[model samples]
Target: MRSLPVYVASVEAEGDRDETLRELVTTDDPDLAEKPIVENFTTEALGTGLRSLRYTQTEEDRTIVAGVRYAWRSQEAGCDVVVIAAAPDPRRILGAMDDIDAFVEQITLTVSSG
Candidate 1:
């Protein structure tokens, strides 16, 4: 069996939540194969969010990479949290969707009372 690379990253940003989420999925790179598949979703920890799946061709080797990004805004915290999962093979990304969903679902943000 062949092994593929998988990547997961998360970031928290303080700014316009909607705009932050939009920026997370937007790319001006010309290497993209086509427009990404974007959709809106609601999560238990976060109220409303966006999920985007995009494919891009590497400039060096021209290999295709599939990246899935999930962005959620914390109204109480006044910030947005974005999570990204990517793999060299699109099938690998698809296979990890469920695990990614569960990981995102378990995220809980805490705000200080001060």
Candidate 2:
């Protein structure tokens, strides 16, 4: 776990969740533009009030790995929560690319309305 070289964090923001997620997925920044996209998806059925997206990329040298996950807390307030992570080559967390869904399902979120 500690040796995986992975990073993870969460952010809460107010906006059109879907639109924000689209922007992140379609970023035009030159540096990121060159990184290959490994996966992208959205869903409302995974967990309670969760509308989410997952994106992953690997550097050409294969020395770096990065991923982003976006989840909308609900359809009621346009609230959005995003989780992001990065690490050195070939994620060792789940061992295989096919295990991503299982890895994602392990993520838990708590949303509080103010």
Best by lDDT: 1
Model 2 regions more than 4 Å off: 1-12, 24-26, 33-63, 68-70, 91-100, 106-114
> Model 2, range 55-81, lDDT digits (tens) per residue?
344456534344443343444433444
- At residue 37, give the lDDT of candidate 1: 86
lDDT of each: 0.75, 0.43
Candidate 1 lDDT over 1-114, as tens digits, reads: 344343334565667777778777664446678888888867887878888888998888989999888888777776677777777788988787787777777877888788
The runs of at least 3 residues in candidate 1 whose Cα sits more than 4 Å from the true structure, single-residue gaps closed, are 1-16, 27-29
- The lDDT of model 2 is 0.43
Which residue pairs of candidate 1 clash?
A: none
